[model samples]
Target chain A: MSEQIVSDSVSAIKCTNCAAPLNILGGGRVSTVTCEYCHSVLDLNDNYAVLSKFEKVKRPLGPFKIGMRGNIKGVEWTIIGWVTYKTIEFSDEEWNEFFLYSPTHGYAWLVYEDGKISLSMKVRDFDLFSWKVKKPKTLFYKKGHYILDDESYMFYIDYVEGELNWVAKFGDKFTCWDYNGVGYRSLSIEKNINELEVFHTTKLNKKDIYSAFNLEYSSKSKTRKDETFSDDDESPSVFNINKIFFIMPLLLLILAFSSLFYSKTVYDTSYRTNQKENFSIDSSAFLTSIKISVSGVGTANNKLSLYKGDEKIFYIDKQKVFFIKKDIGKSWVSNAIAVTIYLKLDKGRYHFIGEKNPNQSITTVKIEQQVIRTNYLIYALILFVFLLSIPYFKERE
Target chain B: MTDGFTVEKSINCPQCGDTLPLYFKHVKLVQCLSCKSTIFLENEATRLAGDSSVLAPEISLIHLNVPFGYEHKSYLPLGKIRYSYGRGFWEEWWLKDSEGNEYWLSIDEGDFVLEQKVDSRYSRELFNTLNVGQVTFDNLIVTETGMATCEGFEGALPKTVTKGDTYLYTHLSGKDASLTTLELGKDGVETYLGKWISPFDIKKVG
Candidate 1:
């Protein structure tokens, strides 16, 4: 949320404490500056870099080499041969120094000939001693290890007085230690003096550099803008609402036409015959028989029933037929009815071959006919009514 | 999949008569957006009014029957359902003996066995006291004791058991075996236990 550019270079020094970019201050010379967040007085001088010292002493039995690298007080350096504390006890050179390339803290161990120069930080506990007015040293810390043998060593470093030291004792138990005042405050030991070494060059990894410098680089960052869908800067479809409005009415019209106006009608002939109705056509050739046939379009079973005048007749289940004949028997003659029989049809839909007694056929005749068909207009009406009435009955159901 | 079948009319709000869009995810409940009237779809299906419920313009809700009994048991009712395209779906209740445990359960054809936690009755009582709903039962009763004439028979109780846990009961009548659906509440009191027998032809047993 906040940005600052304190350095002249494109990349700037970032604070390990506050994440704030540090500006090149005091004409590009490293100088002490206070972190605004933690109020820690950070020493940035190029003269002497702070080193943590541990002080449990053990000397190497034989000559050994300890690795070191870094810059000392802004000056580059490399590892030199180590000085053993076994040699330092009989020598006057109390400080041992070495060289490496740590730009901020210089080399690890400062080893010199004749002995080792090192700083040992001690912790004083006032409560443990009687007459307890002053504190006695409880822990001693050193930075680099001095090898007395392949199995024996002691670590030490200098934070003040600019020195480094190591003395090796094989089985002696020591409790006093020093701290590289830069990170931790103090270091102490509990069992053998040779076991007090905590940091070793062999155990170093990429993460160790980040941890030592207190700077993190592998963290992921997220923003609120990435969470939601993005809208284009220019709005192009504002007028599309009108087009949708026009399309809705057209859809409704099409639906209405499909249900109401569409009609697929099929017509055919059907026949019913008894002996009396000797109605024979010229070879009985016809496209369809409508008079005798019944149509079933939309009924529950899709069937139609056919009947005769006052008498039950055959059922014509299908839509098409040929002809229907009824018998003229002696019973009609005995009942004083003429034997010459003619077809008595329902709804006058049947065709006749002979002239109906020209005198008797002068008037109209009504026949019984049943036709089954599905009225699409009725279906459409029902759909329309249901849609229209939903608004009124929405809450009722 | 039918050609002529179409949504002829849109359901409208009862009061305003405005068309309302309907969509369902789980089919647990259907609520009218306008009037907030909720319908249980499962109830409709069980009542044989599925067609009528679907015809209604409002949302058709479904009430899911929770799978009862042990989740790991093969006879759990939810597992036995089998579905087909033209034949719909049906379930068969079967009985099996697992080690010493006997059960009448339902299971689908191809489902894998599931592992579930079985708690004790004392834990159930404690969980109930704490108002926790997820108490399970682990103790299984074996039929080492002699058979009895009543539903609750005196016998050797399950050794590992707690105070207030629930367990499923399987009843065997003649050739048929079925899991009893026990209702915990009363229709009219403090506690009333009811059982749902299968609707199909059942064998007679003394």
Candidate 2:
């Protein structure tokens, strides 16, 4: 491929097999370049010879793209490559590894796994007095003691792209031993046929990584269903169930206040032996129905006549409605009788008159307006609370 | 063993006939001050080698004849040799600590390893069969095995390192991040025991 020798920042190197422009960001140390356009792995050390070709590979996801310049720690690095891998023991497990390059610091790795991002660098000063090969129960690194997380495992390369410092193919495999330590730090021992490298990794905060790349700061992290969180980087979750504990009670209080505001007394009057009372119904969304109650004793034949602007709607005669007499407390003796009438009145004034017979005994009369006759406010609150708990309990488990 | 250094002299370069002042101890090879040609000492005779090639010097942390601190101890670099491999190159600096002890500090990119020559009983047959990542009977893991050619030289060296000489080397890692490096050339296999040093620990001594 013919190209111009411009500055180090610009590259015109093209893929030999596909003729796609391959940027040489890794400089003279890069051994391979996988053409992102054609999925052809080209050996950079051997004049870009095609070494491997990936078929039917899907592009990986996440917030990283190639050639993004960002500062990690103190050194500025340009993302030169990206690779996707799946664990051989757990085929469903997958992650993306980005190769970062700095001229003075050489190459490093940034791994995105389980909604978390971590920086990985080669470590040769690992404290070894606390370690064994097969079943290392503990590891000491960066002065922190770490325990082996289960056991060592192997992984296979599922996809490859851009430039790498070594020759790698689509199906190349490697064995790795991982140990999680304190302070969001982890150490891994990676071994293949050609090299054995130990890496020290520290989990990066989302805010740091996003701001370094000039990205919008999103606090949520993507996690697997069975994944857990650590203390240092907090957590990256889709929804926080703890928020429901704060917001649900405030919402319930507002509904209860609305229910109370709807049940109100628009008009009230009393019956004194023989008298007539007048009331008005303006009619609103909250006050739609009007009710009248006649209170008396001994099943009197007392009655009240209701009218709207001289038009008689009906009469509410005293019925056998009795309140359980607390006056006796031994049995439900009828001490007072009340007859109620619910009327859907239009926008007009109304009047009522009650006539007491010579043998009739009428005590008092009351009238009220209501939006609904039966107050289902308590039942509605119970249903609302039950509906909100489903997601809360599912997230907790 | 000169705890304090001895008398130094100047040698005339055979290629350019220029006088070169020698300040380093046990000089086996030196570069002329004017011609930049590599010169070697064959017993009492001095011979001229090829022109010394210079690696990119802007990124190097240590300078020749300058004192640096490592692990709270001071050391001065007296010699440097650069070797180029297939992918990249590395450098080995000869250092003498304040207590008069000497070491070999190798730097590849940002990684540093400090070494010192050790007496060994391993035969040539055993060294030939070692490969990268192969564990030996002594439980030492061979981490790297490669061939590199001499690219440049400066100051003084104890071993003959004329420009453009190729050699094979192997690195074995043992307990506590300790390692042993073997350089096999016409001088046979020379073994050195060492450990990886955190580059941040090396600072310019006041």
Candidate 3:
């Protein structure tokens, strides 16, 4: 794999238990190498002897397969190990932990739980704090602040596969304290049989993880590394000059094409109703927002309502809505005044009808449909245009 | 520091009477490459300490008299001291930069910490009374404290380190990956300040 760190020392070795071929990529400090095919833990210090075996247990499924390599930041690491753990309180709650190994940088972990993945690295440079001490709501580490998630929970290891830095058993228990930091970063302290291992984790999106392992590309991940983590060398700005240069023209270009598929009119008509019947506007083709503009000169007490077949979305009561008289210089209506009501609607086809009063005056209404996305696109284009030109006008000599 | 150092080419092993090459002039001890006897050099007098049990060549990345570098600075490794703690052993390489500034590159497992002994005026009496996890008076947090035994030595060292000599050492962590090591030995407490270096940064050169 392109993500694998190539070294002269790394070579494929056979599992001592089942003689299954395994590729070990870690350093000399690695204590155990678990065979993925036979589920046997091999102790490296003792001539690769089989320490334990789980012949009957089934291996837990994870997103990335063993031996797959991924690049985190700039360093490439191989997924050498995987451990599946279940919470003690809830048997169904489980998480799969994937161990990453870089020959020079040591070990790291990637955890998958509840459809979310997080890349974790062991925390060094520990200071004055421990689980024995009461955890504050917010705590500082390195340069970031993390908020405590909960009291903590205990979990037991259910299954294991592949090589690990330490030995693994079937039922080893560990207590975990998780804290959420800003952006996609978080802190977790895992207390096991011997030591407390704290990890600084950055939540990984689908795009990064997939691309690193050479999987099919996904563009849906919204997390940008620059937005979450800030370096001391880079000064934060409210607007990016390069993005402004790229986005203004792009948004306007998108706005011009939005009429074809998404933002165009799906339904538009003017209706004059004097009878006790409903006017239907079918918008089954589109699945976005539609603007409904209703206007009428009321003859008596009446009720106007917009609906989707049987479901009445909202109703305008004549008792509450009063038409105000206006003078337009040359023309003015004294008895009958036209009241215009504009409604921004979301979702399915609509049925507009004055169902309450039969003798209601002839209400004239125009229904125009333009998805709400076009409005934001137009606004974004104007904003980027203004932002981009401001820098050019600055630093006048 | 090797400010006024005059390079001593070779020295006779006190026990075996065999010649061993010296890279740095401020050599307090030397291990004969042939005889394997650790010889302590003080003025003109030399004493045979014992057999030097060196680590396997595969375990260490550096070699005596071999030059290595990072960034703009280059260093010549003169000697090394291997210390064994409860868990594992760590090696401290005695190196001299191009400008003759001596440094101790401590590599424990894979964690590398390059430190240089501070001047006498920089020492603090308050540093003597620090325990593990206790913050020092200088606001540095004492991260680790343990007894480390001198396993062996190779080449030329700046100080005399006898095999099986045990000393209590305390590691204090400071800001920006800065580290302060206090070695409480039979002589006294000696402190060295340096930063934690990424192992990828240190590369073996000619």
Worst 10 residues of 1 chain A by lDDT: A119-128
For residues A269-294, write the lDDT of model 2, one tens digit per residue.
55546677787676644334334333
Backbone clash pairs for candidate 2 read A221-A236
Candidate 1 stretches with Cα past 4 Å from truth are A1-359, A362-376, A391-397, B1-206
DockQ of each: 0.01, 0.25, 0.11
lDDT of 1 by residue, A186-239 (tens): 232222434323221111222233232232423221113312322221111212
lDDT of 3 at A375: 57
TM-score, every prediction:
0.15, 0.62, 0.50
Clashing pairs counted in every model: 103, 1, 0
lDDT, each prediction: 0.25, 0.70, 0.67
Model 3, range A1-397, lDDT digits (tens) per residue?
2333344456688999789987776665577888878888998778789999865468765557677777876677778788889999999888889888765466788887654677887766444244346556667775565677757899988988877878888888998877765446678888987667778787676556777877664322222432343222211121233444676678677765765555444444444443233443444333333232334544444455666677766554434432222221322123334444434555456665653233334444444444444555577777777866554444121
Q: Which candidate should be chosen as best, given TM-score against the real structure?
A: 2
RMSD of each: 37.8, 20.1, 16.0
> What's the lDDT for residue B124 in model 1?
18
DockQ of predicted model 1: 0.01
Residue ranges of candidate 2 with Cα displaced over 4 Å:
A1-12, A27-29, A87-93, A125-134, A150-154, A171-176, A191-196, A214-397, B1-23, B32-50, B56-58, B133-139
Q: After superposition, how far is residue A96 of candidate 3 from its true place, in Å?
A: 2.6
